[model samples]
Target: MKWIRARLADGNDEKGSACAPGAFHALLEDDRVLPVRGDPYNGHERTGEILRLDDVRLDVPVVPPTFYCVGLNYTKHIATEGLKIPDKPDVGYRANNALIAHGEDVIMPADATKVHYEGELVVVIGKRARSLSPDEARGCVLGYTMGNDVSERNWQKSDRTFWRAKNTDTFKPMGPWIDTDVDIENMETVVKVNGRESTRFHTNDMLFGIDTFISTMSRYLTLYPGDILWMGTDGHSPDLADGDVVEVSLTGLGTLRNRFVRER
Candidate 1:
């Protein structure tokens, strides 16, 4: 099932009142959206009211309890940057304030130059888990989504941490929706800048796979429902300019499109 968080385009609260007030959870069917009573982490109960898919504006699919990231997981991307591959899986963190939905503008700071996009696959956790084996790790995942890990090369290199370089507001563009059924092992990731292909790679071509990261991380901290993990991207991106539109598409998962705008 494909689940989306959206507000009706009509600007009225008629149908939205049937669900969870603000941005409601809807089941995406053909060209229609059926509002659900609850969220994906809980159980999705049908509200019986269906709206045209075109008659709504999307919001970030899930506001996770924690935003986790796996850096330097791709061998090709590691080689591209002249960096060594790590012997073990390591998890990093990202801020929720940086997250924006599809079709939103990525505000490029005025002083930021050499901005680039890292298109990645985002995993949505369904159940709370801890210290699981690779086999058990898969059971905890709800589904997958797409994320554009926008970065500033200059600040990334200068700052000891990625506080501003990567976590600036609107820097992370994620989701049109989340797919509960996707063939993770057979997916491909393609990135385009202004409608032209910039990077493409086998989505599962990571130095360490999803099971490795989940199983490894669960050893120390608890993985709760609504927590998201961004699987790192492969290859590199060209320097993005203001007004450039970036589209990150994964097999089965819908494309996430965002435009970059330089703050004046």
Candidate 2:
């Protein structure tokens, strides 16, 4: 079942709805499309009364209580910048609170010299999990969404710590929608800046896969519904600037697009 969050006409309220990520998906089992008694998540099928998807503004799929992201989980990305490989997962660095939704503009900091886009595969947690085994991590995943880990390269490389580099308001571009039950294997994680392809990465090359990522993080924190774990990106992810159109696409799921503009 595919789930989406859309901003209502009021411009302040959001209504979750049911929709197919692609034309091939079935909405019958989707509680967001059709109602069923005593749904597990209490998700109601509130379709039609709400405006059509093309009409309503899209937002991030989940207002996550936490956003846990990994660094250098993909080998291709490591090789792209001529960086050394680390033995264990790079579990430091995070971006919370300032995550921007899909179709939202990514603000380019006025003082910043350069801001680059890092396209990645992010997991949306549906089940609450704590200290789960690596083998059990995939089950906790609610689904997946496309994200661009927008960063100020000037700020990022300035210091060893990454907090400042990742959190400028509107730096994160989330959505088009969250796709459930996807086979991420061999899927293309592509990034395009201003209609030109910038980076191409495959899910198959993830050095530490989703199962490993979930299991690893669960040992340290509790994974709850609406929690997000962004799997690292692959090879030479590119940069975006003011007036640029950015699109990230993953196979099975559709493409997510956003615009970037300089902050006044």
Candidate 3:
């Protein structure tokens, strides 16, 4: 089961969020009474017009967005990059642009010397939460999805913090789709740079697991229903070239694909 919010991008249309309530629990949770005007997820609910997927574009899945991201979430990434290991998890900061939906072109600044793509598993929030225990964190998760925390390396590592590095316009590419049934907390993900595997890591090596990370972050800020935790990449962020097809993949949510082409 999955939960998503979608809208038609071809023309001016109102977007909406819905539960993909199916025999699956995530789908079961959707309000079947409210059907989407179009989209595949609507057919199961019989609430809205079943729009052809090819006919409309997908927006970032969640609405009423609250974004929370992490740094150094993966352990192998730290080891491989020869980065200083933090005594505790490095929850450096969260950004404003990490809440994007699917089918959006991630921005690549014209003046940037180097920009890298981070393939990660994203945890989406299902309820309003604050200071949750590790055990309670997963319960509040709406599901797991894929994302690319596109970063500008110089700005991220050299600048004060990652604010300018990771938060560029459309830097967050999420959701070919979302699924709640999968064990995304334990999945292995890989980032392909122009069809070559750059970084791949299993979640077992993460210094702080999803539960602990989410719980820790909520303490610093209020997390709302549509909040998301962008799991930082697994180190091997290869530089992207114009017209580069950057693909990120997780075990259950499949591949979130986006191409990097310089704006004219």
Candidate 4:
């Protein structure tokens, strides 16, 4: 099942009522979306109202309580950056404010000269867990989604932390929807800039996989429903410019596309 959070596109309560009841939905096989009574973690009771997929606007799949990230997980990406691979799985945090939905514009800061996209697989947690074993970690995940970890290279290098460089508003474009079933081991990631493919890699080609990150983080902190972990991307992105469109596609999962625009 693919879960989505969206609103009717007829301009009624467009900005307001994002979290209103019946906003959560399930994408049906017949190209329709069915509003559900509850979320994916708890259980989704059908609302019996089905609408054409084209009649709705997609929103961020979920408003995550915690945004987690795994850094330097991809070996190829690390090698491309000329950095040493870490021995242990390390988890980082990202701000929720940076998250935007598919079709949104990623606003490039006026001072940012080297903006890049990191296409990644986002793990959506469904069950509360702590001290999980590597094998148990997989059971806690509800599904997977795609995310674009947009970064400003200049600030990323100059600043001690990625506070602004990575957490800037609209920097993270996630969602077409979350796929409850995914073959992670067989997945592949392809990234395109303005209709041209720029980066491609095996999605599971990580130095540290999802199970490691979850188990490592769960040892110290609890993983809760609605929290998300962004598995890092592979390879590098070219310097993005104004009006450039980026599309991130994961096998079986859908594509997440966003345009970069200069901040006015």
TM-score of each: 0.97, 0.84, 0.79, 0.94
| Per-candidate count of clashing residue pairs (backbone under 3 Å) | 0, 0, 11, 0
Q: Write the per-residue lDDT of candidate 1 for residues 142-173, one digit (tens) a residue.
A: 99999998999899889999999899999999
lDDT of 3 by residue, 1-264 (tens): 655555443452534434232211112123332234333222333453444444345566654365666777666677766787677655654565554665566657787768888787777777778888888888787777787878887887688867768877777778866687897547788777678887777855566778888778777877777677876767677678887888788887767888886756
Write model 4 residue lDDT over 70-143, tens digit each, in one string: 88998888888788889998789899999999999999989999999999999999999999999999989989
Better of 3 and 4 by lDDT: 4
- The stretch of ten residues in a row with the least summed lDDT in candidate 4 is 15-24
Candidate 1 stretches greater than 4 Å from native: 14-17
Comparing candidate 1 with candidate 2, which one achieves the higher TM-score? 1
* Model 2 lDDT, residue 31, Cα: 32
Instruction: Assess the local accuracy of residue 185 in candidate 2 as a C-alpha lDDT between 0 and 100.
Output: 84
Cα RMSD, each candidate? 1.3, 5.2, 5.8, 2.4
Residue pairs with backbone overlap in model 2: none
- Name the candidate that leads on lDDT: 1
